[model samples]
Target: MQGKRSNQIVQNTAFLYFRMLLSMGIGLYASRIVLEVLGVEDFGVFNVVGGVVSMLTFLNNSLSSASQRFLTFELGKNNIMELSKVFNISVSIHLAIAGLVVLLAETVGLWFLYHKLSIPPERFDAALWVYHFCVLTAFFGILQAPYIAMIISREEMSLFAYISILETVLRLLIVYLLKVIMFDKLSLYGILTFSVSFFIFLLYWQLCRKRFVETRIKHFIWDRKRYIQILSFSGWVLNGNLAVVGYTQGVNILLNIFFGPAVNAARGIAFQLQNAVNNFSYNFQKAMNPQITKSYASGDMGLMHRLVFVSSKVTFFLTLIPCIPILIETNFFLEKWLGKFPDHTISFVRISVLITIISALSYSMIVSIHSTGTIKKFQLWEANILLMIVPISYFLLKKGGTPEVAYWTTLVLMIIAQSARVVIVSKAIDFKLYTYFNEVILRILLGLPLCLILPYWVFVNMNEGWSRLIILVVVVCISVGLSFYFLVCSKSEQRILNKVGFGFVAKFQALISRYSLNK
Candidate 1:
């Protein structure tokens, strides 16, 4: 059973990796094209305005996890009937939430976009147009949640990856369309983004309605109890999600008020690079999350503990891979990737990457806590900690601190929040705090010294050029690989890595042998 779970994780990760690569390629390309076409101020305008409306996403994200957890839990029990009920109730809740959001977006969200945001007077109309369609995109995305959650709960990663690739292709098309269309580029981009979102949601809907037995709308049955259960679970989940919104959208607003749209442009560039780097670990986590949840449902605390620890370690390495080179050469990377940098972009990217590293360690732990379905104290404390970023940064900037002050605030808060995560999760599970610190956290800390040596050497010796960039990447690759292999990984992990390597080679040899024999 353990081996089967491991194989499933491996297969899921294999699919997600393909998704990541396609997304990275298409995302990097699309961003460059979009940035160039929209120019600096307009690009910033889109991000900031869109960001305000995105605050509505706090509900969307919270319910996604709530829905996926209940669905996966029911499937683990082999209760298809209950699963269908859960699906219907989740959709009902989401539809209700979507309506509420539209009401708010038209009233409160619209007012904030116009009155509170620091959008330029000239581009106000473009920003307003973007806001209207973004509301549509956000609404449809919420309604699309149950199908997406169902797909993920079934561990149908290939379907998920394929849908993502399609979305990537559509985004590429949008960028292409952005160039030739004679209308306002910003508004066109906004409308096209909504159209793409709606189309993708339809694709998910069609696939789920056909494939998943529980997705038949005609047979769907709703339950008030199930609604209450999911609501009870999600209500506690709301604090953490709202804090995330505050931490992100709130900070973006603060930046706009203080530093103007050009600063927001810089921030937009930083987030693109950050998200690109973050997608590596995110893909791995997506593959592992279901297993983590399922193990708990099966009363296998032992397997749950092991999966959480192993996943945390592997994904930390996944993040460190790209982060090392980028941190070593931020200016060079941004200048090459985007061909232009706004103010504070370099510092923002660096700080955000560092925060992502700390956050990666706590991700599996958080999933474990969620699986237990008792997270009120955990969410409240963590949310408060994260919520500090906005006001802290606000005060700092008011005192004349740099824009980087916000992310620095985030970095400090994340460290505190992560430590709190381990503590909170410890009370709910059998996790040994000492073991976590000794086994997982210690390895990462020990690896840092080794990881930094070569990158620092390259930084001091090399000049700013393509040659330097290439050499820096090579050095980071070699050093990080060696450190993770010799320093971070256990003997068992190293053996697993070796076996996978040898197995692939052996398969290739067997294939070649058969071909030669046929000849």
Candidate 2:
């Protein structure tokens, strides 16, 4: 059973990585084209306006987390009936949340957008169009949450990957159309983007209905106990999600107010790179998340702990592989990717990479805490720590701090938040903080320097060009790969790697010999 689970994880991770690679490639290209078509000011307007709607979608995020946890826990117990019930209830809750979002977005979100945002007077109308489309996109996304949760809980990663690829391709097509079609590029982009989202939602809805019995709602479930359970979990989750939204989107609004749309454009470009790089770790974490939840639900604390520990280390290494190259070659990459990106783009990308590295280590721990379904205290602490970023950033920007100060603030707060998570997780699951520090943090600290030394040295000595970039990437990969194998991985993990490597070579040789004999 353990071997089977491990194989499944490997297979799912492969599918997700395929999806990430294609999506990231196409997404980076599409973003470059969009920037060229829309120009910086319009791009900034879209980012900030869309961010306002995303702020309210934190409600959707909170409930999405709850839905996945409950569904996965029930599936782990093989409670088919309860799984269906949970899905229906989750659908109900998401519907309510979706309506609430529409209300908040129109009244409060709209008012704030018009009154508080720093858009040019000419672009105000375009921003409003973007806001409405974003609301529609969020509405569809909220309604689609339960089906997505069901797919993920069941570990239907191949289908998830397929849908994600389709979505990315559609968005790419939308960007292409933005260039050809000639009606208010900003407004048209917003509408086309929403169309892609709505179409993707329908795909998920139909796929879940056809594939999973749990998704076929025969009747509305009004389980008071289940409602209380999910809502209780999500309520605390809401606090953490709110803080995340506040720091991210809220800070984007602040940048717009303080530094104007051009700066917001820079931040947007930075985040595009951040997302591209971070997807390496995020895909792995997504593949591991279901296993963590299922293991805990089956009361396999030992297995769960091992998964969390190994995954935390692996996530950091995965993030570091791409991050190291980009961190060293930010300006080169940005100039090549976006011919004329906004100011501060390089600083934002560098700082965002650092932030992503710290945050990557927390994914497995967060999943483990959610699996236990006792996130009240955990979420409270994380929320309080992360929530500090926005106000502190506001104060700094008000006191004439530059735009990068906001990202620096986020980096510091992220460190504090991750530390608090480790401490809380230690108590909640009886996780040994000493073991975590020694096995994960300590090893990373030692190995990271080794990973960077060669790459940085090559970067500094070499001139800036495509050849240098290629060599730097190769050097970083080799350096990080060796450090991960020798310094980060435990003896048991090394043995597994050796076994897998030998097995693959043996299989290849046997296949070749058999084919030669037949010939």
| Per-model TM values vs. the true structure | 0.96, 0.97
Q: Encode model 2's per-residue lDDT on 333-380: one tens digit a residue.
A: 988988988888989999999999998988987898999999999999
Q: In angstroms, give how far residue 472 of model 2 lies from its true place.
A: 1.1
Question: Can you tell me which runs of candidate 1 are displaced by over 4 Å?
Answer: 499-519
What are the lDDT figures for the candidates, one per model? 0.87, 0.92
**Model 1 CA lDDT for position 20:** 88
- Residue 126 in candidate 2 has what lDDT? 87
After superposition, candidate 2 runs with Cα above 4 Å error: 500-519
Best by TM-score: 2
**What global local distance difference test value does model 1 have?**
0.87
Local lDDT at 224 for model 1? 68
Q: Could you give candidate 1's per-residue lDDT for residues 1-519 as a string of tens digits?
A: 654566677778889999989999889889989999999999999999889878977888889889999998888778888888899888888889999888999999887876778877888999899999999999999999999899889999999999999999999999999999999999999999999999999999899999997887774456767777899889888989888887788988899999999999888888877888888887888888888888888898988887888888888888888888888788888888889767788899899899888878878977889999888989988998998988999999999998998999989999999989899898788888998887788998888787788888888987889998888878777887898889888898787777665766776799999999999
Clashes of each: 0, 0
